[model samples]
Target: MASDSSFDIVSKIDRQEAENALNQARKEVEQRYDFKGTGASIEWSGDSVLIKANSEERAKAVLDVFQSKVIKRGISLKSLDSADPVASGKEYRIVTTLKEGISSEDAKKVSKLIRDEGPKSVKSQIQGDELRVQSKSRDDLQEVQRMLKAADLDVDLQFINYR
Candidate 1:
């Protein structure tokens, strides 16, 4: 009997790449003519990113710059969750946290999709923060990947450990 083929689906971010993007955004904010004297700044505050500016519009602009940089670095915007600008004394601040790992609920959603739409031979199991999919046919596994990619899921997914 032929062995089953399997792969794992996960959501993860590359921290170094995210940091590089933030640095690029900070440099642009420092050099931009419009940002002069605005006290605009972007920096890492512990595990999260902090954006501060003199006004709400400027703070949002700073966030836009950071998002553009991240996109240019090939990171999905979905993984970056940013809060609305909030007034803090004289400045407006926006805090953003990077999201990684598929939650158990999200894993269940993927498994459901596989059961409802994937080939009959395919099976999916939730394993902590990731989902493992197994099938007797490699072609079915590839189809599952394509189907998942086409689905409009909020979380960013990566396929790994295919065999």
Candidate 2:
């Protein structure tokens, strides 16, 4: 009897890496000449990230720096959900949240995609916030991974636990 080849699809972020990126962004904002008088700042507020500046443009720039740092840390930008800048008192603020986990709807969408377009031997099952894909052939599993990578899904996905 042949056991099926399988992998788990998950959306997750390393909190420590994210925090390092935030720290790098904050240091850059503090040292950058243009941001000297802009009062630009980036910090963690609870589980979310906060970017504040004297103007909307500056606040957005601060966000840009943070995003770049995140990218440098090998985190996908798709995982970041950043709000538009809003005026708060004397500063403009942008609140950004890191998205993790596959929601039921997202898992369903991926499952559907697999069933509709993936190899016939491939099977997908949604397990909580993750999806498990199994197939008789490893090649089929790889093909499914390629298909998912090509799809323009809103969530960032990672393939793990391949065996």
Q: List the residue pairs that clash in candidate 1.
A: none
**Total clashes, candidate 2?**
0
Relative to the true structure, candidate 2 reaches a TM of: 0.97
- Which numbered prediction scores highest in TM-score against the true structure? 1
Evaluate residue 52 in candidate 2 and report its C-alpha lDDT on the 0 to 100 scale: 90
Tens-place lDDT per residue, model 2, 38-122, is: 8888988999999999999999999999999999999999999999999989999999999999999999999999999999999
Per-residue lDDT over 1-163 for candidate 1, one digit per residue giving the tens place of the 0 to 100 score? 8999999999999999999999999999999999999999999999899999999999999999999999999999989999999998999999999989998888888899999999999999998899999999999999999999999998999999999
For each candidate, what TM-score against the reference?
Answer: 0.97, 0.97
Badly placed stretches (over 4 Å) of model 2 are: none
**Candidate 1, superposed: residue stretches over 4 Å from native:** none
Candidate 2's C-alpha lDDT?
0.96
Candidate models: Cα lDDT each = 0.96, 0.96
